[model samples]
Target: MTAWRCVFADGPVDGKVVLVSGGAGAVGRYAIQFAKLGGARVIATVGNAEAAASASGAGADLVLNRHVDDLATAIAGFTGDANGRGVDRFVEVAFGANLELIVKTISPNGVVASYASDAVPEPKLPFWPLVMLDVTIRFVLVYVMPKQAHLEAAEAINSALEAKQLTHLIGRTLPLASIVEAHEAVERGDLGKTILVLP
Candidate 1:
């Protein structure tokens, strides 16, 4: 989130319907809340009831089971009443895994903004549809930056946070000794911040 999460504070993701793939995961939890606070509608995909509860409590508008009978139909149904025909954007955690279905579900000119990729390196991008729909694929690289710009952005974000306008959805809290297990849970899609408490 140190990188991709900035999308929210920057307002580029404001007021959009962002379909989050790992919507109940660590990043997903915060992404959901931040999007809502930013005035966007959040459609999150959770693995089960507990995750759904957590997401809803954190402010997600709709939390759907990822094991749904039909992802496309479900997504389409969710965004049916959208001001726009389909989702305005996607905060995708599994872009490669969900690319085909995302393409089928998104409206023309919709964008898939992704960050997670531990598998399937270099998958082919849908160039034609992207061009036809005028979709933009944006990547966030956090390492490269000038300190001045970073400070400016940070100041702005801090101002928003101080105003209580930017909400952060923090998930499970873990004890210091359980850090490894906590990390595992996050990788397994346990949503929210894996905070370690020191005794």
Candidate 2:
């Protein structure tokens, strides 16, 4: 629902350049797939080799290390827009940490759909720059999404699943008795999805 809301709610992503930050993470991975499925060119950023591989597997056209020194230049090069007019849509995981980068790289009138901001829960925005770019900042929380949005997302997900267009990555699966272990893994930021099976 979060991915669908971020990728499709604003408009069709066809032919657009969509950037997914933390593209190996759960939401980021889904966003990458959805953007690709919608015919958008996708660029995903990750912190490690494993994450880079995961994002690539999820169908990102370009996967870059988020810690690169000149991220904006790299993005511009990938988009082939020398003018630094970056992605049309951004699915951000660390909105606060990436605010400056977003402001620098997002195209005019682009939309930024952010789901998490653990790094800085309260971030100060570069108001003038964002305003000048006419950027739309959307904070998404799946639990509070509108009923209609949920329905729309569910339908899309079902269609995608039926068509075998979606894939899930299970990092670990543990019996119900091992729930505490599963919780610990999640707290440690284990990669992929963790599932607890009921015996």
Find the candidate with the highest lDDT and give its number. 2
What's each prediction's TM-score? 0.76, 0.97
Where is the poorest 10-residue window by lDDT in model 1?
1-10
**Residues 1-199, model 2: lDDT tens digits:** 8998999889999999999999999899999999999999999999989999999999999999987547898889989887788699999999999998898889999999999999998999999999998999998988999999999999999999999998888999999999999999999888899999988
Which 10 consecutive positions of candidate 2 have the poorest summed lDDT?
Answer: 66-75
Which regions in candidate 1 have their CA more than 4 angstroms from the true location?
Answer: 2-15, 81-85, 145-153, 164-191
Question: TM-score winner among the candidates?
Answer: 2
TM-score of candidate 1 against the unseen true structure: 0.76
Write the residue-wise lDDT of candidate 1 on 104-134 in tens digits: 7666777776776556557678778667777
